[model samples]
Target: MQKLNLSQSLSQKLSPQQIQFIKLLQVPTAELDTRIEEELEINPALEEGKEEETEQSQDDDFEDSYDDDLGRDDHELNLDDYLDDEYSGYKMQGDGNYNSDDDDREIPISSQTSLHEQLITQLNFLKLDDRQKIIGQQLIGSIENDGYIRRDLEAIINDLAFSQNIETDIDELEEILRKIQTFDPAGIAARTLQECLIIQLERKEHPDDPVVKHALLIVQDCFEEFTKKHYSKIQKRLDLDEEGIKDAVNLITRLNPKPGGASDGLVRTQYIIPDFILTNNGGKLEVSLNSKNAPELRISRSYADMFDAYDKSDKKDKKLKDTVTFVKQKLDAAKWFIDAIKQRQNTLLRTMEAILNYQKEFFIDGDETNLRPMILKDIAERIDMDISTVSRVANSKSIQTEFGVYPLKYFFSEGIATDSGEDVSNREVKSVLQGMVDAEDKKRPLSDDKLVKMLNKLGYNIARRTVAKYREQLQIPVARLRKEL
Candidate 1:
């Protein structure tokens, strides 16, 4: 049996233009140029460079032409025959203007070899059997960027068997690893910090020297004590005086902890392109978007003239009609994109203006302690936008100030309550905590409990766990690790 059913349902959907704008809003300044280039390649009617007419004239012409054409109903002209993304009837094509300076603007390529490549080059000097050579290469590949092989030997053996069809045990791998550790870098493939130090210490020019021997002993036997700065305990066990231990500690400290990092000098540096530029003109902060963000884009003048010609003709010819359909689609897309760009520019400025106004004190004085406790909701209310919009801006955007270039989100922090009934940014508390740690005696570092008590006396009543969390965020080690010889 068949039954006919009728129901009405209502749902909201975003148009293609809206989806594109949302994506564009999230593109950081580094990538916005790429996105614009892609759009220019695809959309023929959308071209770069402003129209020769004045801004007022361009707006008047856009309002007159695009609005009239885009707003047409079927009663005036039929759109039954048109091209779309899936439609293969007609193809729209436009020649792109490639900027010659773009090539010059790119960062120059480096000719220096990377660390792993150098390791492989050294492997050529080893005289091993075919199987042994393969295992050696695999071991070198397993080494991390920091030149340490943290992976388990057994796991690597299994991987070699499964992936490379090489059957080897841990002893064979360990033997080969010892050879790799002796490579030119002094401590290339050590498994741990102690091993890395010992490898370097053994390679020292005067290993028999008293200071060198003591340094080796400290790294090999008293590594736990060395890391915890328990020099007195190490001295008692090794029967070394304070002067000898101090010299040994100084020698060990002079050795490079990260051998692989030495090769990074040849690597190219990364530069951050800020999305917003904030200048303090005599304490009056002026906010502006990056110049790259405000590219001069306009409707292609030739395409506009073609549309005018098409409108003048009462052509019943199919060829003329086909051209009209293609032009209409491109024009519509161009106008939508232009409008979206304008909206995105306005939205970015509005959101950034709200943030600048809210954090004016911090910007003017260049003091992080003055930063207020702010969240997305606070900016959203001021700018009359959604919290999500503010989040999108804050997540990827950065501002260059007199003090430094900072990510926009760095200004927004969680609040902590003080005993005086005032709210302060958690960043302020972290700053204070860091200051105390910096001033503490290295041999007597303050524990988290002590830090909490000190902070309480300073009027910030936070828990011990919170103190530990903040210390970890600041990259400060535990009290034991902070001790010195």
Candidate 2:
């Protein structure tokens, strides 16, 4: 049987304004202009530009009049809360305002043709029938950005039959593929890395050269051993001398691993617009938000005038009341949006300032080892904000320093204990590990165990697994794969 019971529970919920602030806070400087433009389009009451200076006494009088005119009647809506100036003390001196440096922030676009277009242009030069041209186009379409057509011939044959409804066989497709492979990039449309390298080598001017022949032979015959760097096995199997093999290896190493990377048309270049600009002035670090982040915004003056007109009108009909309600909503939305943008600017500055102070040593010297072990909680507590808020700021934001631009996430790292009982950033460990790898003998690369021992010798109390983890994170391959001739 069900019984009625009274239960009390407490819960916290974000108001509409607070939710709006959170969303605005996370938007990076790059996309902020677009977001603001969208708001301007939807809300007629909101506008873009500096808020003109008006008489404070007049604004106070307007607010007081609004409260008195719209009494506390159940039928009448109270708009006194929204009548006050939402932009008071909003403008920060020398911040979020127009300046001379605004011209430098514009990004120039490239008009170069893409990779696929160039390939298709070359395809036009081929003398083929309608069917052959279609197959050639199909093969070209299968080529990835790396310039390799990794799709299996059988699968492509099925795809053409099912999707294109064109009956084609493996032999006919392969013929067209070979013709396309003869394109300008030399290695374009190759099925495998070995084939890609061989295709490039075959196009060399001096095909009869001894080194070229050896390189082709090594790639075509002992590709697996060559990839594993088993130079001795390759020598024994090929019955070649050390100098001959080394020269051939050196020649193969110079070949382009990714032929498509050379083409300007296929790859879209991405430019990073940093959210903050940081500079080293004498010994002090200075950080400022990118000018684009600080847009000039204000409430439309005409919209404010509507409230004055509504206040003076003696007749309060149903239609007029509905119009006033609509005006109030638009005004409320405009005020909240402006307030959110202002709060976002303040929050971003606070979070970034705390980070700069916390990692002050690293920014000063541009040294990874100098970075301390910092987490979201550290910055959150310093700014009296939540950890999630700090994370939202760091996740999408970047700062341009005198040395270089870096994502805010780069400054945070876990701590590692040293023999001296001092806590150090794991970035320091990775830095040392990278140095060791770079200086290691090519013929005998250091294993994870060896790296762990070396690190421990330097007074770092780290385990073998942690060293392996760091090695992988650095994109360093295993000892076996790193072996070289």
Candidate 3:
């Protein structure tokens, strides 16, 4: 059956310009330059640098003359077709303008050879045949960032036989694996945590030292007890006294748990470029965007001149019409990009201003306790924007404060009610919880139940389970795990 139906409904959709604005708004200061560069490469009409003031009046007159000349023909391109309230020329936000001082400053970036490359370089030092080198390379590939190869040798054998066309037995693979485990890191490619620790201990310059010998024995024998903090069990199983066990445990803790992390200096350090900079001048806190966010962008003057030249020429030629259409599209894209960048700057300032005003106390003193319990809705309402818009700014953006650089998300936390009938930030409670753990007797660490009671005594209405959750969030272990010899 064929049928046609119509019903009244309402729906909303984002225009191309709106979509572009949303994407640009979410980009952080660190990535904004790259995004602008991509746009400049793709759209020939969009260019970098400030728009010249003298050219503005000439461009306006050219547009006016072209509009009047082209408006008469139905087939001719109309300049007004691309002109709208949403379309805007190059406009600058004064706060984000590039400062000559900032341009002159040099930001140091740390670089290093990656972990895999270093491992391969070390692999090259081993004397082996071409086939053996290939097998060794395959083994090196299996090492993870943490410097552990959890894959079974049998599985690797199967992989090599199928993919590399090398039929090697587990013995040959184990021979290569043992050599890799002895790499520079001292624990490079161990199969397990125990193996990693023992490998490091065995490689110690003073392996004959009593502490190193006992540490190796404990790691090789009573690893489970050592991990569970069952010091009594480890003492009984290893026949070690308290001081012997303490020294061995201390040595074990000194070993790099993640061997790959020991080579962090050999990895490129990630720098956090803040989107906002907040400074407390005397008693007032001022917030401003990183100068990078406010990029100087404008429509290409050559493109604009080309459009004017084409529009002023004869309109009867089909080739000219096609060229005009293409030029108009590019101009439209350039205008849209400039307009979107302007909107993004406005939105970022608005959202960040709301957040700065809301947490003014925290910024003044750099105290987490001073931070108000804030959510995306609070800032969104204050800025008269949507919650999602606020979230987009907070999630990926960071602010450089007097204390340190912190992600915008760090200031946002859930509220907790106190006995005084006032709301406080959950971060405050976590701070208190961390303080208690730091000052607790390690031999008999405070349990969650004790933590809850202590918090309640201090006028915080918290439960044991809530205390446990906060503890986990702070990366603090249970009372048992926190125990010491």
Candidate 4:
């Protein structure tokens, strides 16, 4: 038997307050409004109203009415006093502080019809009977967002029989699935890549065009070889020149590999909200957190009133005990939430301010050459926070500079030492690589080794493998693939 030792270590754990802070830190400005709305919906004690009316009503209702009643009356004092506010105001800033009025884009909340919905809509136009339509609807629902139906025919057959109470043969279901694949988005509802390509080929406007017809034949008979870029075999079989092969390859590339992706209805748009805004003001770099992301948040005045009333109320009433507990819990939560929001705003500002200050030269010049190699640890050390915390802040957050909106992570790069003992950012190296590729002769593409040599001559001692890796990262293919007739 193995002896096991169990020991409880006393380590400082994050309080709920701290957890709430981290959560708030992660929310970007673009989604802050929605998050605020969500909070207002969940916490009834937290109300949203105009600044003036909110203050006056809370003071008159809670302080003047409830506070007096609670202090004077000995009658098993009503706990309602604990729920009234003295004065509360939620100041929604118009220009800065989590709400930039300049950004006119408004995200509509109405749910758009999804890809499945659109498919079902098309299915409705088909001349199928009620039963067939039901089967088609079931099939459409089974197709995933990518528009592929990975489930086997037997599984779909059983689903049709048991779930929908409609018996259907495997062959019948496959036929219906094929019909669905033939819908407007050429390759949608396909069971396999082969099927998708075939469906697209069938829908081609000029199906008899020699290049397309040859490409279709290649897909049908030699998909494996074609995928491996065995262009010689394809050319020999079709008796086509290098130019003809290039055109055939171009035609194949034009076909949608995933037909379902063409329908915007099938995809969810991700909106990026920047946490910081950087602008150049008279040769100085100015940085500010997008205040719109950090709404004017505070403890709901009503909760504070409730706390006051609870403090004044007689402590023995059973009803008042639960209400008091409830008030304390909510007040604690509200306070934590507000504190978290404030901390998040402060942290973001501090981090971004450090970045702007550190990269002031780069921002002012708008040149990659001026970028100093910096990382999350550098910012974390500057701000006196853990590296992980800085990373979390930088991960999804974006900054809107006069140049363009970029992810905060984009500014950070590792340094490489130069011969003169100067550090250079890898970003600068990538920029150089991109420039070289852009200026390289297409007819005689530069190989990774040649590119490495070119960089070495330019005083950057980078290895060939590193050059290849960076080139691949930039989405540039190998020299052979880059070669053009």
Report the number of clashing residue pairs per model.
0, 3, 0, 9
RMSD of each: 6.0, 7.2, 6.8, 6.7
Candidate 2 clashing pairs, residues 3+ apart or interchain? 114-265, 115-265, 115-266
Overall lDDT per candidate, in order of appearance? 0.81, 0.84, 0.81, 0.74
| Each prediction's TM-score versus the true structure | 0.81, 0.81, 0.86, 0.80
In model 1, the runs with Cα more than 4 Å from the true position are 1-12, 42-45, 52-107, 110-113, 128-130, 254-266, 302-337
TM value for model 1: 0.81
Q: Considering summed lDDT, which 10 consecutive residues are worst modelled in model 3?
A: 65-74
Best by TM-score: 3
Error of 4 at 284 (Å): 1.6
Q: Per-residue alpha-carbon lDDT of model 1 for 132-237, expressed as tens digits?
A: 8889989988888878889999998998999889999988999998889989688889988889999999999987999999999999999998887888899999
The local lDDT score (0 to 100) that residue 162 gets in candidate 3 is: 93
Q: What is the lDDT of residue 33 in candidate 2?
A: 91
Better of 2 and 4 by lDDT: 2
Tens-place lDDT per residue, model 4, 26-93, is 77677778887777556544544322222222334345533322222222334564445322323234
- Which consecutive 10 residues in model 1 have the weakest lDDT in total? 68-77
TM-score of 4: 0.80
